[model samples]
Target: VLESFGSRGQDLSTEELWQKVLQEVTAEELRAPLHRLCALQAGWWLADRRLGSITSLFCLLRQAEDTGRARCSQGENKLLYLLKAWQVPAEEASLPLVQSAEDLKETLCTSAAFLQGLLELEAENFPTAFSLLKEAAGGFCSKRVLAQIYTCLGCCAQRMGKPQTALQHLKQALQVDFQCLPALSHAAAVYHELRETDAELQALALLYEALEKNPPGATSSNPRFLMQTELLVCTPVLASLLRDRHPSEVKYLLAQRCLQDGRVADAVEHYLDVLTLLQEGPQQQVPLVGSSALPRIPEVFLEAASALEQAGRHQDAITVCEEVISRTTDLIPRMLRVEEELELPECPSPGEGLAGLSQKKENLRCLAWRAAGYLHQGWARAVLGESKEAITQFSRCLGDLLRVQLCGSGVGLTENPLPEVEVLQKIRLLSLIGRGTQFLELGKHKEALLDFQHGLQISPGDPAAISYLVLALWKLDRKKEAAAHWLKISQSPPREDEQVGRSFPLYLMSCLQQAVFPHRESLSSRLQDYL
Candidate 1:
């Protein structure tokens, strides 16, 4: 009955209705379609008016979970029917059942069981989750689902602190599906944590090599692995990894990382390379095409501006910031379009809803992420000594953030982000430190002190920061108090990997050593003076 809603009548198709529901496009927009679907379902009495609400709808879906827990049964097809009824999207896909058949609508044995285990594992019901998924190991199913089962088992074992068990599961998972991205990622992480450094690097390299290929297929063999590697490693540490990779977006990264590593000349070359690429590409278009549209500013001009700004060209910096901001309208849209296209889930149908769940406000989340990029970019500008310009950038980003909130999604633009409050606090602390440094550099000693004090309050006793505070106090001529602060810095020794900062403590000790034992210096020099 639901499938009859094409060009024939007011009847709506099940898949289309499901797609729309999964999207959670505001119900107001769904009014007409809702009226029709409701009439048809009501006529058939499958509408389940009692499950009008999302949470209640979830309870109805829980039957699928129950079937998995019961080791698979007749209720499997009923679950798919419920999924259609709920109108979930295919790509933001419903949980796969334990693949009793190629057509999931017929049975939910294989993927269904894995889905149950995944949820249970997440909830820390390790043993139970493990038991549920392992049921399909010997059963007929896709190697992909089988790979997931092994990975889940590995993670569960790792959480239980059973190293051997975890490794065993990882080996099994990899054997089942060598290209399983999640399995590889988790296996690498676990290997690193367990001190299997060689294995860890090997796994990391495997993922990187796979990502470099940009695999051509509906699945891309593991999109998360590719996207996440860029997010996790490429932007942070594995900077050398970018050398052999795509030279387009890579130049910006090289410039940024070079700045991070204090290699100014390397940064200059790469930034120049980016300019060369941009100059040769179409520079006049509204939405610049391809990798050349990066930075949304003329690379030559901006790179020159960056070089000048870093060399204390405040006015020249402002000129660059202004020009880039002006030209950004055309460039930013291009870059943003690229990002949006990347975000689009597999060949999205004209009106399909694309969230893990239909009603989760995922569109709002995606928008928020774009706005966050602006907010972070503003902060980057502020740190590079573009004071007034940074404020404007920050203001613009904050405004965009506010716009996201007003648009009314399930979440709001918060100082604290979802699922990770600790991380937000750390970011806020870093912001405080940045502000403190700005104040210090600009000769606002009192303001700098306040910012430092607040940063200390947020993250008490961090030696790097505490050392900076002590230096600030000493420079401000509070030697006695500052010396005491230095003592606190000395008590916590540097980690083995970071041996450079031990000098600050040593400097303080030398001063104190001289004061405490003024007569002792003569022992080492006794040959000349004592004779």
Candidate 2:
């Protein structure tokens, strides 16, 4: 019975062993067997986050004590003491029964100190908690418990404003038990407070890996009190830790870091993982820390497409753009007027107050989202040398942008323009430049000239627009005007060579390959000498 219930219990299913305990273990056998049973069950329950089950077991052990049939063993007593200490403040609960044996006295004293330290930690008494944990640290305990002790020590140090010392203790916790995740989480927080973006990213990446390695529900065979994560650390202090974020959110953060650091390929892979997780739908079981950290789903798709474009995966970029387009296209209204948006009903009328305002805002977002999709898809097609198809996409983008009309006297477009107006105007400029370049590619110089001049009116003195406009004039035999325009751009002091290289926009790059500009050097070089 001891072998089945105690030593080899983990090999059997929890339910199978539990059933055996119910059927075969007798009243006379209950004392020693009950200690083993509570010890084993406490570990499983704590690890599984089934704290209610542990409470029931605690009550059952208490009943055995009342009957004088069970002398709770030292390990069981320590487990109960820790669990009781973790509760929020009330009148102090009775301490677990201590054995009278001389050798066990020191061990029980150390365990008492650990429990006191936890209570002090919970009450935000950092100095007291730090002192008690230090006293407990010198005594013998299981490595996992020692890891928890170190983690608490780290937490106390952080509260005491000794972040570097806190980090040292957190590192020690990980060394004691490499799977100690609370230490990793606290370290990440410390790194964040220090403004160590790269270190924080590394720490968050490690924490994420540890979490994925042991999904919370996976029952482990070693059922020694698996310290509940919440119990092991203070909630309010390390509340901003990335551990609270869903794994997908963490991936999104990591991807943003990689992209910022110029690791485009790595960013692309991480973004793909995020998109896959999102497509599987929200994981209701895992609490998302906050949705504020994530971009909206369509925005994330657009970011991924941009990253893919930067990585030179033009076809993949186009496909992602298509995904955004297909999803949001139906949501966009056929036309949007700024006047209707501004005049949303102030008083509640059947479907008309906040709901009406929200629907209008959503429609505006959908319009912007679909227009962005066409812009990206058109740019990708231009990159792939598909001039006619690219022109079609660019025209479609312009058609969407043109639907947003500025109407009504109090629109305040000049002083406080609506978001949709800003988005529409920006996209309109890009779409015009894009289609104009495509027009240049097909030798339609007059049409290309009109598009470039119109884009210049929207964003006057835009370097790319000026450059394309010059090219269009040069193509149309207006040499003196083209040279004058080129000279105006050259008068601005040159930026860094890398900046100059990138200053030429993506849409205009296709214009460089046009048959009209066939020369020994690139268009920028041709423009330099054209005067």
Candidate 3:
């Protein structure tokens, strides 16, 4: 009959099963299954609206406890504590069940301390909870119980502002049970507070790995079901912790790892997630991990644009660049308008003075990033054969790059006054190279030659710049000069693995091949040697 009852309970909804047990099962038949059900449900049954029936069930459990049944004492104490924690109203008589901890502890094992610790922890009394958990830890031989005790201690320490202590407790929890999700989650929070980003990510990664190992519905047993449900509940907590903290930086790092591991699709998804957050701001009402600073949004966008282009999503790459362009366009004009409106005295007001100077510096930095974005957009357009549009983009890029101001020697700044100067030079060289390539494709050999020469002045031994210079010279019928450049290129040392041809597109290489050696048979015979 007990086996049949268990089977029937499994087939019914939780509420329906409890109703059936209350209506048809006799008091003597209820004790075992009710205890089992409470353990399997993991306190979910407390959320149901049938409070009166639940209270009556607790009353029966208390009666069993009074009869000196140790198991019943432990179970009744747990249920009563859960009820109090969740603020569920119980009969006045049942209140004594929670206060009967001394009697229960005398009968049961050290779990009585664990139960009291959990109750105090939930009630936000950290010191008492920590002491009780510490006392309980030595008495448990079960890894699961020890893990829970340590995890609770970690939580208590964290709430009390002892991050180092919290981390130690969480580490001990993992030492006991490496797959403890609560321990991992708390460790992640502690790591974030300590500004140890790599550790935080490692903890989060292990947690997700553990969740994947035990997927939902992998088993029909009560313990497995409860664990699966707990995993589901904890998943969102991970996401929330990430979003509340440096989400953009975390996603950016993850994207780089994915790219290194040859997971291009995953990298693109992570990059896009970073862009979306920066573009839309964080979702409303999500709790932050700590006092997180804004991420480097523009730099992240530039990287995502480059990654998209590498993955052959040219149009998407162009769209991300356009976002940078739009932001800069809106920002620069507003900043200029504000600067004009704020009249400066010999000594500016403290608050406004610092804010105005900071804003000006940020505007300059944005201009540099905006120019780079345009350069990337031009390259993307050129790859798609839109030479006219690509040239226009490159022209705009050059204009923005030239507008950036270099810090003067007398500025009194301790940091490198012209931090953006290096960025400007690199973008200028790339802009010249891109525009020159477009000119070469359009048969404007003299214009292409001039552009290539200018880029060479910035980077003397850059292979792409030299190769294009050779192509331009050959196109303009300067055969002698072209041969001289080719000889110089042949004598140059091989580029290091990391520095080789990253900025040079393969299509440009093909174009250079055709222009340098017009005859098909000559190109085929020399292609392998040149490459």
- Cα error, residue 191 of model 1, in Å, equals 2.9
lDDT of 2 at 212: 74
lDDT per residue as tens, model 2, 1-531: 647445355676655565455455556545443554455565455434454555555554454344443444664444334334321112123534322122232343355456557667778888877887887777646676677788879878998999999999999999999777778878877887777878978987987787677754442435333332223334333333213445666677677667656677988898898788788765713343453346667877877877788788989988998999999977888777667245556567885677777777778778877878888888889888999999999999888877777775444324445655655666677788889889999999999999999987876766667778888998999988987887777787753432232232222222222212233246567666764
Q: Residue 112 error for model 3, in Å? A: 27
Q: Over the stretch 1-531, how does candidate 1's per-residue lDDT look in tens digits?
A: 223322222455543444435334333444434433432332222222122332233333333223443322463433323433442223213544332112232123333344455556667787876776575454434566566567768878888788778888888988988766656666765876776655765665565456445431325334322111112111111121111223344345445445434455665565656556556665312233432324434434444444444444435444544554455433222111111121346676766636432222333333333333333344456646665554445445434333322222322213222322222234344445555555566677676677578767765764445655765675577766666665555466753422232221111111111112122234224322322
Overall lDDT per candidate, in order of appearance: 0.45, 0.67, 0.60
Off by over 4 Å in 3: 1-250, 260-262, 276-281, 284-294, 333-357, 407-419, 492-531
lDDT (C-alpha) at residue 485 in model 3: 72
Candidate 2 structure lDDT: 0.67
- Higher TM-score: candidate 1 or 3? 3
Candidate 3 overall lDDT versus native: 0.60
Alpha-carbon deviation at 144 in model 3, angstroms: 13
- Candidate 3 to truth, TM: 0.48
Q: What is the lDDT of residue 261 in candidate 3?
A: 49
Q: Which 10 consecutive positions of candidate 3 have the poorest summed lDDT? A: 506-515
Alpha carbon lDDT of residue 277, candidate 2?
A: 78
